[model samples]
Each structure stands twice: as structure tokens, then as C-alpha cells.
Target: MKIYFANGLFALADRMFNEVVVDKIRKMDSNIEVYLPQENGDINDKMNYADSIKIAQEDNKELLSSDLIVAILDGDTMDDGVASEIGLAYGKEIPIIGVYTDLRQHGVENPEKLKAVGSIGENPFAYINNYTIGLIKMNGIVVNNIDSMLAEIRKYL
Candidate 1:
């Protein structure tokens, strides 16, 4: 199964998803392919926001070609570009498996919730809830770990 990863690109969280989680998934199944935006996408050094969006568009196109998407929704809020990629996957009818490590960190018990002291005025729970609605509204699956995400993909594959 081809899995497109949607997550932050300029932080340690992104590295964790790519280095540890994605690698673990690859090791679990040799046939599974993971797609991510190329490095140098950050606007911190040379690239600007527009350049980053351009890169995201290219990557999203590649992701749209994949069989499914496994997104990392660990940040306080969903990545804007990642949300756009999710939209593309939705448009293509590709199954999405959202992987969130911050599930319990924000007082969230399940995929549908909000925190007591919400951060960003919305909190991580809101992010999960929005993504869950988007995924379920499109008949996609949601998971909180790399293993579970891979397992869900396995069911369809």
C-alpha cells in the first residue's frame, strides 16, 4: 500500500514521524511506500511561504496518486498544508488514516473531544475532532499510532 504522510516539516515532531514512525512502518511491510514533502520546505532559511506552498502542492499531487494517506496530527493544531493534502485525498477518494500522538495530552479520551484549558483557543482535541469529522465524513479511518495506522491499511490492502 502506498502511504502519503502529512505532518509538520520544520520541527522535531516531523523528524520523529519520518525517522522513527515511518521507518517502523516500512520495516513492518516492505511493500508499503511512504511519501513526504522534500526537505528544504521550511521558510526559515531561504524559502518563502509561497515556495513552501508550491512544494506542498507538488507533494500533495504525489500524495493524491497514492492509495492512502497516513497523517501525523500531533501538533496543537493541524498543519494548514496537511489539511490541504487531506482535502486532496478526500477529493481523490483515498482512505486517510490520521496518526495522532497527542491524543491524551490535551485531555482527549477519544477522537471526538476538546480540552479543559484549550490552547490556540481550540486545543489539540479540536484538531483531532475536525480531522476525525473530515475523515469519517469521507469514509476514512483514524488511528493514534504508527502500528495502528499500518494495521488499518493492512485491512484494505
Candidate 2:
């Protein structure tokens, strides 16, 4: 199976996280092929020069041909490139597994947390773009952690 791994690649931590997750996914099955954008240094290398059109065309080609997309939605906001990839994948009918491991997303049952929602600037919950999430849920699902994400991927395997 071809899996498109979409996530932020700008920060060192983000790039390392993407690599670790992709490694785990690849280890799940030898037949699985994960296309991590960071791996394409030719286009993603900051020191090098890759035009916007070239970058989009290259990544879009892999995205469109993938059997699945594993999108990381853990950032402060959804990474723009990842969001666009999700949209394209949704339009193309490719299944998506979104990994949203934000810690603030927890504590649903805490009274203080729930009550804080009514207070201005005191809300403890994190907000992700509902439209992007909706698109993912329409054709696939959003998982809270890497374990759950892998579990969902196993279903396709």
C-alpha cells in the first residue's frame, strides 16, 4: 500500500517526528510504501531552490496516487500543505487517517475544563479547523494518537 505521510517539515522536531512515525508505519508491513515529503530533499531542502509550482506538482503526484494519507494535525493550526493534501485526497476518494495528538484535546470530563469554556480567554480546549476535520471524517477518521493511527491503518492492511 502506498501511504502519503503529510506533516510540517520546517522544524527539526517536526521533521524528526515525521521520520519516526513513518518508520513505525513502514515497519508494520514490508509492502507499505510511505511518501514523506521531508524525504524529498530535492524539493523540500530549504538551502536549495525549488519553485512553488515544482513543489506542488511533485507532491501532488505522489498524493494523488497514494492508497491512503496519514496527516498530522497536531500543530497550533493545521499545517497549510498538509491541509491542502487532505483536501486533495478527500476529493480523489483516497482514505485518510489523521493523527491529532494535541494534549489540550483531552480532559473532556473535567468539570473545571468544561466550565472554563463559558469564560472568556479561559477555555482549555484547543481548536482545529472544523472544515478540515469534517473533510477527513467524511471519508475516513481522526485518531488521537500514533497508536490509534496505526491501528486504523491496520484495518486497511
Candidate 3:
């Protein structure tokens, strides 16, 4: 399977996390081929310079050819590039497995947490853009952790 691993790659933490996740995914199956954007330093390396068109074109080419997209959706907001990629994948009928591991998304069943929603500035939940999430749900699914993401991918396999 060809997998496009999409996430924010600008920060050191983000880059390291991407590498670790991709490595785990690769270990899952020898036949899985993952296209990690960070690996394409020509376009992603901050020290180097690549034009916007070059970056978009290169990523689009890989995205179009991919069998699945593994999108990281854990952030204050979804990365703009990752959201755009999700849109394109949706339009092209590619399945996506979104990993959203925000701790704020937990404790939904806690009554105190639920009551907090009635108070101003006391909401205990994190919000992800419904439209972007809708696009994913229409063609795929959103998972809360890496294990769930991998399990979903296994279904595709």
C-alpha cells in the first residue's frame, strides 16, 4: 500500500513525531510504501529554498498516486497544508485515517466536564473544524490515537 503521511513538519517536535510514526507504520508491513513530506528536504527544508509551485506540485503528484493518506490532526488547529491535502484526497476518493490524539478530547462522559460547558470559558473540550472533519468522515474516519489509526489501516489492507 502507498501511504502519504501528512502533518505539520516545520517544528523539531513535529518532524521527530512524524519520523517516529512513519517508522512504526513502515514496520507494520514490508509492502507498505510511505511518502513522508519531511523526507523531501528539497521542498520542506527550511534552510533550503524551493518555490511554492514546486512544493505544491511535488506533493500533489505524490498525493494523487497514493492509496491512502495518514493525516495528523492534533494541533491548536489543523495545519493548512494538511487540510488542503485532505480536501484533495476527499475529492479524489482516497481514504484517510486521521490521528487526533489531543487530551482535551477526552473526559466527555464526565459530568463535571459536561457541566463546564454551561459556564463561560469553561468548556472542557477541544474543537476541530467540522467541515474539514466532515470531509475526512465522508471518505474515511478519525481515530483518537496511533494504535486506532493502524487498526483502521489494517482494515484497508
Candidate 4:
């Protein structure tokens, strides 16, 4: 199966995760294909951030065409661009798997008071913009480990 990997690109961990996941998937099935954005090069110095977004938009189109999307929704919060990719994947009716390394699922930070008035389930001081919201709404599974992520993919593959 063809897979589109989504994650924070600004961090080295993102690259590590992609490489690890791709290697794992390929080991599972050498015929499988993975798609990722081209590494930023001298072009980034030539254009502004907006141009980089334009490049990402085109890359996302390709991402959406994949059979499934494996997204890294880790860190303090889900990356805005990654969220947009999830939205686009949902719009295309493609299956998604959300991978998160952060363990704030219990809503620990800002426990003083809730920011979003009408919230429930540890919402009083929810941190990280409730990363699970989009994953749940998109009918995607939230996995905290690479093994689980690969297992989930195997189900679809």
C-alpha cells in the first residue's frame, strides 16, 4: 500500500520518525511506497515562508492521493500544517492514523481554569489544544508507539 507520512518537519525527530517508520513499513512489505516532502535546500533561502507553504500545498495534494495517512501529532501541540493535512485527508475519505509522543492526554498544564468555556473531560485546564479532537473527529486511531502505528497500518494493508 502507498502511505503518506505527516509530522512536524522543523524538528530532527520528525525526520528520524519518518525514516524509522518508512524503514519499518518497507521491511513489512518491500512493495509498499511512501511519500514525503523533499528536503528543504537552498531554495528556502531564495523564497519566503509563504513560498514554502505553496510548495507544501502541492506536496499535500500528493499526500492526499495516497491510500492512507500516518500522521505524527506529537510535541506540545499538533502542528498547524499537519492539522491541515489531516483535514485534507479526511475530506478525501482516506484513512488516517495519528501518532503522538506527548503524554499530556490527562490535561495537566493550565489546570487552574478552562480556557474554552464549554469543555468536558479535564478541560478545565486543557493544554495543547486538545490534540485528540481532530483525530477522533476524523475517525483516526491515536497511537503512542511505532509498533502500534505499524500494526494499525497492517490492518488496512
Name the best candidate (by TM-score).
Answer: 2
Q: How many residue pairs of model 2 clash at the backbone?
A: 0
- 37-62 in candidate 3: lDDT tens per residue? 99998898879899999999999999
What C-alpha lDDT values do all the predictions have? 0.67, 0.95, 0.94, 0.70
- The alpha-carbon deviation from the true structure for residue 18 of candidate 3, after best TM-score superposition, in angstroms, is 0.4
lDDT, model 2? 0.95
Per-residue error (Å), model 1, residue 71: 1.0
How would you encode candidate 1's per-residue C-alpha lDDT over 11-78 as one tens digit per residue? 76576657676777677777888775534344324445556566666686678789878776667777
Which 10 successive residues of model 2 have the least lDDT summed? Answer: 38-47
Model 4, TM vs. native = 0.72
Clash pairs (backbone) in predicted model 1: none
Off by over 4 Å in 4: 38-53, 106-137
Query: Candidates 3 and 4: which is better by TM-score?
Result: 3
- The estimated TM-scores of all candidates read 0.71, 0.98, 0.97, 0.72
Number of the predicted model whose lDDT against the real structure is largest: 2
Question: Which ranges of candidate 1 are over 4 A from the true structure?
Answer: 39-53, 103-132
Top-down lDDT ranking: 2, 3, 4, 1
